[model samples]
Target: MSGPSQEVVAPKAPQRIVILGATSAIAEAAARLWAANGARIILAGRNEARLNKIAADLKARGASEAIDWPLDFVTADAGAELGKMVDRLGGLDLLLLAYGISGDQGELERNPAAAAKVIATNFSSAAAWSLAAAAVLEKQRRGTLLVIGSVAGDRGRRSNFIYGATKGGLAHLVEGIAHKLAPLGARAVIIKPGFVETPMTAGMANNGPLWAKPDAIAPIIVRAGEKGGPVVYAPTFWRGIMLIVRNLPAAVFDRLNI
Candidate 1:
């Protein structure tokens, strides 16, 4: 029998973390930036060899332990497979779902199937996999879900409506998830970056005010996670700029053609 004077013991902290899109440039940078002193990691992605390499690299660079779980996002059961992997990892301190596919707007306009696939990967697939994370975080009542979004989602663009629409849906998804998850002690952070140079956008011009490389943007994400914030802009300066951008009249905004 328990008495009022008796004290209960708290569980130990979780050491394992899983990054669903392990091979991505920003995700790997995140792994490096947030390794802590000697954390354990479970890298999961489409390429088993790449995941293995990432795991080995993490272990070499201050991570106490690291392992790879092969996961293919193109497969039909990506969500279920990732959920099982997270469960097997025992407990996750952070779960990052950062899958993105660049869509060719010109081709997408001609082919409905192409646009549909891109949307599925960018929005539907991400949502499905994140549901897996949400379930685990809620059960644990203590974990973080970080999703990398883009400022392109803030407004539709003539050059890439297909891609912008996908990101728009993602923006909405992150907002909804953050509100629902906050009270449970589990939380989500939506990272809206303004033009980072990655393999994804090397061909694009880099003249924007806060344009930066993935390396520069990564530290911002790590800081946000450490500080426990729900939304973060990669350069931090974009917060004020976006506030003004969002408030401009649609007629003026359209004529300005940003």
Candidate 2:
């Protein structure tokens, strides 16, 4: 009989990693860390200049290979493009989806087009890319899929519910996909970060103990992809914070401002 001390080991560092939102602060932090560890990275995003700069930095930081591809996820053919990337890399060991816009909540409420853009960027495009990537990983029967979500997704708050709704939708989709992929030896991880100091939140008053820097959260995201559970909260305390929010009774929750 096997001993109680037996433990399953995590897979090796992924050789080829596809970062969908390569220019995002958190993603770029993760890319640099992975590059330093010798991962081959394909940085895909809309900003060609930013992509090139980050790719060069990754190479300088010791990435085995660093390349970039220009992509506007809202209009691009996700399935075809991801297929080409996987083929170009020979095989994919990890795929990170870290792009999203924190659409103005008040503006979204007043503008239908603004709301649609948020939905497209946060949910529709991500779903499309996830399906495309899932197909490839399923066939290969290996790889890790890491998605950056938000704690707001745990429940709807009036402050950012528009953005929260999109993230909530994504978390639900990936949860179902995780089960489906498990049987095939593939893993899907959802990283729910609290208040991070990124460009997306630059306009907001992000100072104080609650806000985290990109570099602080980056390692947690990478480790979750490398070896961890399906859902993770960067900095970890956010998990407890959200648990309280989620379990609040409807009447009590509605009376207070979050």
Candidate 3:
């Protein structure tokens, strides 16, 4: 038999999708995509108002159902609370974990608290949240756990090495979690987008052929989730770019300003 076509593999399903960082640009956009594709949405975040607003927007656009689940990723009990939220929601067909922080490395170098906060937001919270989701997903024995990774993690840039380090750690964490969860009939998809036009990146320059919008990034991610992509780069080209950068000769690579 001929293998399934890519189109056949990625058609949208009218299932329940929970967006953990529902207020963030990419997460909000992903929520909208799933909502538009006939999924019920559980918009989750620390701000009930923000999540409710997103739910209202999703309902206006024809989602089957929309609800808000207020969650604070920074809390000491965040992991356990997240596990409870999963049970309360009656299981999820898709889980989107997309919270992040843009760190000011200069200030972080001087302030230990600032440094820890960034690491917590970018790495600790993310891993914990994904782990919680994976626990339920594994028990169900069928579901997807998708989270945003960072291309910046592939290699360090002097401009934001601290941020890069945190993301690098996240990339490894999710990849390992994905492998562990695979046998449980659950899988993880890691998304790495080269600068996107979102509130977090509003003032940043578009890096040559690498820039993309949150709108552009969201659909690609949805498709990846539906089709079981392990690690996907938004806009596609970044895959080739990262491959080259990751394998560059260290002697010559260190000389080039990445």
- lDDT per residue, candidate 3, 18-117, as tens digits? 7878898988887787877677877778889888888899998889889898878867465677666666667778888888888666898889999999
Q: Could you give candidate 2's per-residue lDDT for residues 3-45 as a string of tens digits?
A: 6896778668888999999999999999999999899999999
Runs of candidate 3 with Cα error greater than 4 angstroms are 1-14
RMSD of each: 4.7, 1.8, 3.1
Across 1-258, the per-residue lDDT of candidate 1 in tens digits comes to: 965786666533336777878788888887876565576777878888888888878887888777787776656575567667776777778777766988667899999999989988888888877777777788888787788887778777677878888887887887788788888988788888887877788777887776787788767766655445677877888888788877888877777645
Candidate achieving higher lDDT, 1 or 2: 2
Per-candidate Cα lDDT values, in order, are 0.77, 0.92, 0.81
- Model 3: C-alpha RMSD to truth? 3.1
What are the runs in model 2 whose C-alpha is more than 4 Å off? 1-10
Off by over 4 Å in 1: 1-14, 76-79, 207-209
My TM-score estimates for the predictions, one after another, are 0.87, 0.96, 0.90
In lDDT terms, how accurate is model 3? 0.81
- What does the lDDT read for residue 47 in candidate 1? 89
lDDT for model 1 comes to 0.77
Ranking by lDDT: 2, 3, 1
Best by TM-score: 2
* Model 2 weakest 10-residue run by lDDT: 2-11
Candidate 1 residue-wise lDDT at 114: 94
In model 3, how large is the Cα lDDT of residue 86? 64
